[model samples]
Target: MTRESGRYKGKRVIQGGRAQVRTVLYMAMMSAMQCNPVFKATFRHLVKAGKPKKVAIIACVRKMVVILNSMLRDGVMWDANTAKN
Candidate 1:
């Protein structure tokens, strides 16, 4: 969450999606954070900035979801540079 945890907890991330897709996206995001330069740097920065690892992971996963949605909407191929932007 962006502000205080007390104010943000349980109300931060949206929790509505197909379980199967969520699981796959979570796994893919984890793997990407490990090997993809974009996600790796983001994870590193979040941790360095004092975010808990789980929080950082969730943030990355959310980002991936947004990127994926935009790609699908635009009918564009996946491109790391475009996603990063």
Candidate 2:
């Protein structure tokens, strides 16, 4: 277990996006992990698969970013079915 041991780990969202944007996204992901059906399920799945909590949260954040990008690009509204797809 030679992995760097510390309170900090991994690069922040997309290697240099706006700080405010990342902060807002991080907050949203945290809330989503607790309340949003889609993200809550994803977080639980990742943790069940042996990922650490922080790691799972980051993964959710990335998933959210991709979902947001795709929706924006396609000019679609948020849909529960779309989260599954």
In candidate 1, stretches whose alpha carbon ends up further than 4 angstroms from where it belongs are: 1-19
Clashing pairs in 1: none
Show the colliding residue pairs in model 2: none
TM-scores for every predicted model = 0.73, 0.75
Q: Least accurate stretch of 10 residues (summed lDDT) in model 1?
A: 1-10
Q: How far out, in Å, is residue 6 in model 1? A: 9.8
Candidate 2 lDDT at 40 equals: 91
**Tens digit per residue, CA lDDT, model 2, 1-85:** 1334476586543455577977898899998888889999999999999998888888899999999999999999999788865
- What is the alpha-carbon lDDT of model 1 when measured against the actual structure? 0.83
After superposition, the stretches of candidate 2 with alpha carbons farther than 4 Å from their true spots are 1-18
lDDT of each: 0.83, 0.84
Query: Model 1 over residues 1-85: C-alpha lDDT tens digits?
Result: 2334555555355466677987888899889987888889888989999999888898899888888899899999989888777
Candidate 2 lowest-lDDT run of ten: 1-10
lDDT of 2 at 21: 79
